[model samples]
Target: MKSSIRRRVLLLALLPATLLALSLGYFFTLSRITDLDQALRARGLAIARHLAPACEYGVISGNNQILQRLADSALAEPDVVSVYIMDRGGNVLASNSLKQSKLAGIQPGDIPVSSQNDTVTVATRSNVLFFRMPIRQTEVQVDDFALTSTPAPAIQPVNAAPLGYVAIELSRKATMERQNEVLRSAALLTIAALIATALLALRLGREITVPIMKLASAVDKIGRGYLDVRVKLGGNDDEFRILEDGINGMVSKLHRAHDNLQEQILQATAKLSYQASHDMLTGLINRREFEVRLERALFSAQHQDREHALCYMDLDQFKIVNDSCGHVAGDELLRQLTLHLQQEVRERDTLARLGGDEFGLLLENCPQDKALELAEIMRKTVEDFRFSMGEKNFMVGVSIGIVMINHESDNVVSLLTSADAACYAAKDHGRNRVHLYQMQDSELAKRRGEMQWVNRIQLAIAENRLQLYFQQIQPLQKQEQGLHVELLLRMIDESGQCILPMAFIPAAERYHLMPMLDRWVMENSFKLCDAYIAPDSCELQTWAVNVSGASLCDAGFVQYLKSHLVDNPALARTLCIEITETAAITNLGAANTFIKELKSLGCRFALDDFGSGLSSLNYLKNLNVDYLKIDGAFIKDMADDAIDLAMVEAINKIGHQMGLLTIAEFVDSERVLLKLKEIGVDFVQGNWIHKPENAEALCKT
Candidate 1:
C-alpha cells in the first residue's frame, strides 16, 4: 500500500518515542523491584546475626524461654516472616510461629560456623528470604587466685564451641506490592508519553503535509493549463517558503507566456490573409504585390482609358537614424510613417513598402495633377513627423517621384525604373520635394551609372576579383617593430583594370553592402597573416584592416568576427582593426564595447583618419585604441601649409601624450617626412615610403 506523507511522518516520529518510553519504564520498574528485594534480604540477614548472639547463652543453658524471647523480638520487626532457634543436633528449640517455617529445616552445618567471627548465610524460598547463622559458647576461666610476688601466669583465650544456630525468614509480599506499584506508575507514565508523542507527531505531519498537498493541487491545476494557479503557503521563511516562492514565480512566467501566446495567435490570425502580400514590419503591401498591381494597372492603361500614378517615396534621414540609433528605431520610424502616409492617401490607393526607407503608392483613375498633390501631401506629412528613440529625436523628410500610368507606359520594369530615376532627381534637387519623371533627367544618368557600379561591385565579389593590398608603415625611430602594414581593399573590373575603393565604396555604402566587404577583408587578412607569419612571429608583425562605419554599426558583424577569431585564435594578436574617427565618435558606446571584446582576445584597435572629426580629441579619451593614423588631408599639405603643419604637430603630440603610436599618411616627400619625424610621429606611410604591394603574392612568397 502506498503510504501518505502524514502516515510516514507519524510512524517515523512516534515509533522511537514509544520504544524509548517503554524501555525506560521497564528498566525503572525492574530497578525498583530489585531494590525492594535487596532491602528485604538485608533486613533478614541483620535479624539472623542479632538472634544468633542473643540465643548463645540460652542454647548453652538449655533455657527455651530465653530462646523464645529472642525469637519473638526478631519476629516483631517488619517483614520478618519467621524466626527459629535450634540446637547443634538440628532440633528446633524456639519458634515465633506455630506453623513450621522453611528455616526450621536449615541445618547448623548449612552455615559455616566461625568462633572468631560471626557467620551469616542467606537463601530464598518462594515469596520468602532466609538468613541463617551459627551460635557459639564462650569458655569459663578456672585459675583466679595467683601469687602477686611470683610472675603472673597469663590466661590465653581459646576458640569457642558451637552451641546452636539461628535462622530468619522474611516475607516478600510488601516488596512485591511495591514493585507492582512502581510498574503501574511507570506503565502509566509511558502511556501518557506515547499519547503526547502521537499528538505532536500528528501536528508535525499536518505541518509538513499541508504545504505538500497545496503544492500538489497547484501543480495539478497548472498542468491543466490554469496558469493563474499559485501555491501560497503560510509559514516562516524556511525551505517551504522558498519552495512556495519558486512555484509562484514559475506560474507567473507561465501566465505571462500564455498571454503572449494569445496575443501572437491573434496577430497571426489577422495576418493570415495578407501576410503573403504585405510587409511584416510596416503592415503595408509588399514590393511583390505592388509590382503585381502595377503590372495589372499598366495592362489596363494600354488597353482602356483608365489612368494610374505610381509614387516612389524615399526617406532622406532614415539612414542617419538607422546607423546612429540602430535598426530597432529605424523599424519603428517606418511603421509610424506608414500610418501617417496612409492617412494622406485615398482609400482606393495602394501603399506598399518597397524596401529600406522606400515606399510605393499606386493611385488608380488619378490624373498627373492629382497624383502630384497627393505625393506632396505625403511628403509634407513625413517632413513634419518626428521620430523619437531614447533621449534622441529625429526629423525626417521624403523625396517622392510620381509617374503617370497611361497608354505610353511600356512595362512594369521600365515604369519602376523611370519612377526611381525621378526619385533620385528629387533627392538631388534637395529632399522633401516631389518630382515628375522626364526622359532627359540628368540625375537619371548619374543614378544609372551608380547602379552599374553596384552591379560591377557585386560581380567582382562573386567572381573573386576583389584584391587585398598592403601599404607599408615605416617607423622613423628605427625600432625593431618588424613589418607594420595597413591592409587595403581593391576591386578588378571585367576589362582587367584595377578600381580603387573611391570608385565603388560610395555605392556599396549606399546599398548597405559594407558588411559583406568588411567580412571579406577580415577573413582574407587573417588568412594572409596566418600563412605569412609563423605562429611564433605574430608579435613581430602588425597588420591593420579598415572597417567601414556601416560595418561597425551592423549588428551581426561583431559576432561574425568573433566566430572567425575562434577558428584562428593565433591570428588575433597579429591583426589590428582600424575604424575612422567619424565612425567611432558617432557610435562611441558600441565602438568601445567592440574594442574591449576583441582586445580581450589579444586583438588591437587603431583610429583611422584621425583629427577629422569635430570632437576628435574629446572622444579619443573614450575610445580604447593602440594607434592613431593622422588624417591624410592634414598630412598631404602639412609640408607647405603652416596651419596644416600645426594641426599635424598637435595631433601627434596628443596621440603620444595618451600613450598611442601616431602614423602620418600621404608622406609623399622627405620634407613632409622630416617634419613628421621632428614632430615625433611614430610611423609614416605613403607612396614616398613604400608603394602598395599585392598582399596575396607577398604572403605566398
Candidate 2:
C-alpha cells in the first residue's frame, strides 16, 4: 500500500478530532486559571492603595510609630509578603520589614509607569510581585513629618514637594500551587485518551494492511518471474480489487509483448549472421568467410599429404560492365555468375567471392594440373555464357592465378601473393587466361614483399633508422674529375643488417608508401650532403637522389626544397633531384608544377631511366630538365648489340637537340663506357665507374 494515500486518509480522520479536543480543553481550563490570577492581582492592588494614604501621612509627620503601624496593616492582607515606602526623590522612608536597613534608594526617573493605566511592577521576587504608587496631597492642612534614621538624607530642598510611593509585594506560592494541580489533572486525562485512540487506530490499520500485504507479496512474486501468480483480494468492494485487476491486465500485456520481442530478436540475429558470412549483392560467401574456409582447406591438405590448389579469379572489364550497364546490371550479372559457377564446380570444391568482381576456388585433393584444368574450364564457361542486361547481350571473361599448397609455403600472405602475381602475369600476357605460379616468380614476389616492408622502413626513418650510402657517378673521359655522388637509402633492420632500397622501393610504390620514404631520403640526404660534401672541390659536384611520383605531386615539395636551399644555398644548387620517366609521364601536370617550382630555386632535375618507359619527345619539350639518363637496359647490352648502340646514338642526338645533357646508366663494362663516351654522353653511372658502396668505402676508393 502507498504510504501517501494511507497517511492522507489517517490525517483527514484524526487531525480535526485532535485539534477540537485540545482547543476545548485549553479554553475551559487555562481561561479559568487566568481569570483567577487577574482576581488576585486586583485584590492585592486594592489593599496596597488603601494603606498608601496612612503611610504617606506618617512619613510627612515624622512619626516612626505611625509608619510601622501602616506597614503592619499592609502585611495583614492574604498574599502580601512585605512592603516599603519611598519619598518622591527615591529615598526609602519606612518599611514593614528590615528596621535596621533601609531599602536601596530608587531614582525617580528610572521608575516606569504602565502606559495603559499608570500601573507599574516596582519590584520582583522569585515568587512575589511588588508595586509602587505615588501619593498626591491636598493643599489644606497637609502635615510635614520627618522620621528619625541612622543615616541622614543627603540633602533636603526647602521648597521640596511632598511626594511618596507605596510598594506592594504579592506572594506567588498560592498561584503556583493552583497551576500545578490543573496541569497534573490535564496530563492524566490526555495520556488516557491517547492510549484509547492508539488501540482503536491499531485495530483499524490491521483491517486495511492485511489485504495490502497479500497484494504486495503477489506483486513481488510476479516481478520475480512468476507471471502466473495472482492476488486474492478478500473484499471485492475494496481498493485492492482495483489493484488486482490492474496487475492481471499488465501481466497479460507483458506476455504478448515478450513473445513479439523474442520473435523480432531471433529474426534480427539471423539477418545479421547472413550479412556477416555472405555478400549482400551476389549472395556468395564473402572474403572473411572465404579466408576461414581457405585456411582450413590448406591445413587439411597439409595433414592428409594431398595436393590442394587455390585459384584466384578476377573479372576482366568489370569496370566497363558497371559503367555501361550500371551497378544494378553488374550486381545481377554477378549473382547469375555465382549461380553458374556454383553449378559448374564439384560439390566438395569451395567457391567464394573474394571482393568486388573477384572470386576464389579452393580445390581439395587436386594437383596443380587438375586445378589449372578447372581454372581454364571456369574461364571458358564465363566467356561462353551470354548475359542479358535490359536489351544488350554480352560475354565476360576472367583471369585466373593458381597457387598449389605445399609444405614450403604455409602462410596466407605467401599463398595470396603467389596467386596474385600469377594473376597479374596472366593479365599481362593477355587477359582471359590462367597462369600457374613458379619458383622463379617467387623471387620477384619476395622482392615485392620486401617493398611492402618499405612502409615499415619509412616509419624507421622517422625513428632515425635510415642511413646513407654514397656512390660515385664518374665521367669515363676524365677520371681525375671529382665525381658527383648518388645517395642510396639503406635501412638498418632490427637485427642491425643494412637493407638497400632496391629491395623495397617497388613495394613502396605498389602500396603507396613512397611519399614518406621519399621525404626521408630527401631530408637525410641533404643533411649528409651538408656535412660530408667537400667545399674545396673545383666543380662542387652535386649529390643525386631519386624521388617518387607521389612525392613529386606533394604540395609541400617546393616549400621543402626552398627551406633546405635557404639553409645551404651553395650546396642546394649542387643537389640534383633524379626522377624516372615513368613517374614524370604518369602525373605530368603535377610533375611539371613541382619541377618548375624547384628549378626556379636553382635546383637541377635529372631524367632517370630515360628509355625504359614511354619517354615521348613531347615530355622532353615541355619538361625543363638538365640531364637525360640512358636507361640501364640499353647500356647493359651496348657492348655486343648494334641495336643498343644505335638506340644510344639516337637518344644522344635527341638530348643534344633538346639542349639537355645525356648520361648513360648501367655502364658495367669498359667497352660500354667507351661506346657511351663516343656517343657524347655527358656522364656515366654503373659498376664500370663505381658500384654503390657505403660512404666510408666510397671515400677510401
Candidate 3:
C-alpha cells in the first residue's frame, strides 16, 4: 500500500510538470527559430532585389560578364552559399558560390530552388536554406543604400516584366545550434527535478512500507502455522492503527483455533488406530490383526517346533437372531456373548472376530485334546446363552472346529484350511457342536475343503468379488465374422490367487449358489460390454456367459432377466447364455421354455460343453440353443483319435442342420484349428487361438 501510494503520487506530481517544462521550452524555441528565419529571408530578399535590377541591363544585352560580376558581389557575404541569375527562359545566365571547401559536408552540385515564387524556400539535402526571387526588368528605386542613378535606372520599365530569376542558398547551421543548446538545458533541468522527486518519494515510501512489511511478515508466519504471531506497527496513520488491531485480533482467534485443532488431530488419530486393529462392538482384534498374529504363530510352529491349537468358531443360529430381532439386538447379543466366550479361554489365548458371525482363536502349546475341550466349552457356552431384546428372548448356538497346529502347520493356508474345514463340518453335521480336524484322512479333508468353498463362493457373489476371464472365439471357417468372446467366471482367494471354477463349482452347485452366481455373471458381463451395446450396432458381437443348471430350472429366473434386460434391448440382442450339456439334458423341459422366452426377447442361447455326454446329441433336439460349444475333452484329442475326429465332424453336421453355429473348444494348435475348420466348425476357442485374458481388457465401457 505504502510503496504503491508513493510511486503513484510521485508520478502524478512529476510527470505533467516534466512534460509542461519540456513543452514550453520546445514551443518557445520554435517561435524564436521562426522569427529568425523570417528576418533572414527578408534580408536575403532585399539583397536579391538590389542585385536583380542591377542585372536587368546585363540580361537585356546578354552581357555575361556583367551578370557574373553582380552574382559574385552577392556571394561575398559569408553566409550566402550560392547566388544565381537566370533569364525568363529559366536558364541560369550567371551564378557564383563560396568555395566548396568552405561549405563543409555540402556537395558542389547543390542548387537553390523556389517551388512556388520568391516567397517559396526549401531546405537542401544538407542543413542549408534555399530560396529564389524573380529578376524584374523594371525602373530601380533610389534608396539611401542603393546606387542613385540621376534619372533612375531606366533600363526597364517599372512593373513591366520579369526578365529572369535570382536564387540564393542560406546556411541554417547557426539556428540549429541555438535550438540544440536550449533542448540540452531543458533536459538537464527535467532530470534534476525528477531525481529530487524520486528521493522524496522513496523517503515517504519507507515510512509507510515499514508497517506494511511488518504486517506481511506476520501474515507469512501465521500461514506457516505460527498462530501466535502478531504484527507490531507504530505510526500516526489511523489506517495503520486499525490494521494492526485487526491483525492482532486475528492472531488471537487463530491461536485458540490451533489449540482446538491439535486436540482434534490427537483424538482422530487415536480413533483411527483403534478402528484399524479392533472390532468396534466386540472390542476383539479384527481379521487383519488376527491374521497377523496367526502368521507369527505359523512361523513359531515351523521354526521352533512349537505346537499350538487354533479353533474357528461360527455362530450357527445368529442369522435367526438377526432375522427375529433387529440388527441392534443382534449387536447386543454378540457383545454379551463375547464376554462369555472370553471367560472360556485363557488369557494367553488370542481370539478375534474374523468377519460377521465367525471368530478365530490361537492357543499356544495346546494339544488336540485340550483344543477339543476348549472348543466344546465355547460351543456349550454359546448354546446355553440366551439373548433378550425388549420383551423377546432367544437362544443362540455356535459351531467350533479344532485343528492341531504343529511343525506341519508351516503356512497360514494350511492352518486356516484345516480349522475352517472342521468348523464347516461341525455346522454340516449339526449346530452347537465341536469337530476336530482329522489331518491324515484324505477323504474327510477333501470334503471339508470343498464344503468350505460353498460359503466362499456364496460370499464372493454376494460381495461382487468374482472377476471374468475372456477367450476369443475366432472363426474357424469363413462363415463366422465379428467379435465373439466367451465369458468365464473366476474367483480370487484371500491369498489373491485365481481359483478356477472347477475348484469351487461343485460346491456352488451342491449348495445352490450357482443361481445367484449365474445372475451375477449375466448382469456384470452386460455391464462390462456396455460399449458394444447400441441400437445401431453394425457388427454382430456375441458374449456367451455360462449359466448354471439350477438357474435354468428356475421359472422366475427368466422373468428376472426380462426385468433387467427390457431396459437395454441392444444388450439383450448380444447376450448368449451358455448352458452346459449335462445341465441342459437334465432340465430340458424348463431349459426349452427358458430358451424360447429369451430368444423371443432377442437374447441367444448356447449348449456349452456339447460332446462331453454321450446323450448330448439326443438332448440337442429337445432344446433350442443358438450355438453349440463342443466340449474341449473331445476336441483336444480329436487330432489324434479317429473316434474324436468323427464325433467333432458329426456334431458340426448336426449343429449346422439344426441351424446352429458350432464352436470347438480347446483348439491348442494350428492343426486342431485346421481340423475343426475341415469339420466345418463355425468357431474355435483355445489358448492357441486366443489365450484367456482379463475380460475387462478386451471389453471395456
Specify the highest-lDDT model's number: 1
Show where candidate 1 strays beyond 4 Å.
Answer: 1-286, 300-308, 315-358, 364-370, 381-397, 404-410, 417-431, 435-444, 479-481, 535-540, 553-570, 699-701
Q: Which candidate do you rate higher for lDDT, 1 or 2?
A: 1
CA lDDT for candidate 1: 0.85
Determine the backbone clash count of candidate 3: 0
lDDT of each: 0.85, 0.76, 0.79
TM-score of each: 0.53, 0.69, 0.52
Q: Write the per-residue lDDT of candidate 1 for residues 378-431, one digit (tens) a residue.
A: 888998999889999999999998888999988999889888988988988988
Cα lDDT of model 3 by residue, 106-212, tens digit: 23234445454533444454676666566665554455665554455334455755777677777767766766776677667667766776676567667766787
Ranking by lDDT: 1, 3, 2
Q: Name the regions of candidate 3 deviating beyond 4 angstroms.
A: 1-32, 35-177, 197-259, 298-307, 325-329, 343-345, 364-370, 389-392, 441-443, 448-506, 510-701
Q: lDDT per residue, candidate 2, 1-701, as tens digits?
A: 45754565556655665676667667766876787677777777787667766675677776767877787778788777777777776776767652322234556565454432453444445666556766545344323464454444443223335467777667768887887777677767766665666556555655676677777777787778677776666776657778878877888777778789989999999999999998888788888887888788777766777678889898887787789989998988899988888888988888889888899888888887788889989999888877898788878889998999866667777788778777776887789999888877754466456545866766776678878787777765555445587888888887788887777676777778888777777777766555565445435576788888888888887688778787777776877889889889898998899888878777899988887776466677878889898888888998899998898899889999989888887788888888888778888888768777776443334
Output the TM-score of candidate 1.
Answer: 0.53
lDDT of 3: 0.79
515, model 2: CA deviation in Å?
3.9
lDDT over C-alpha atoms for residue 562 of model 2? 79
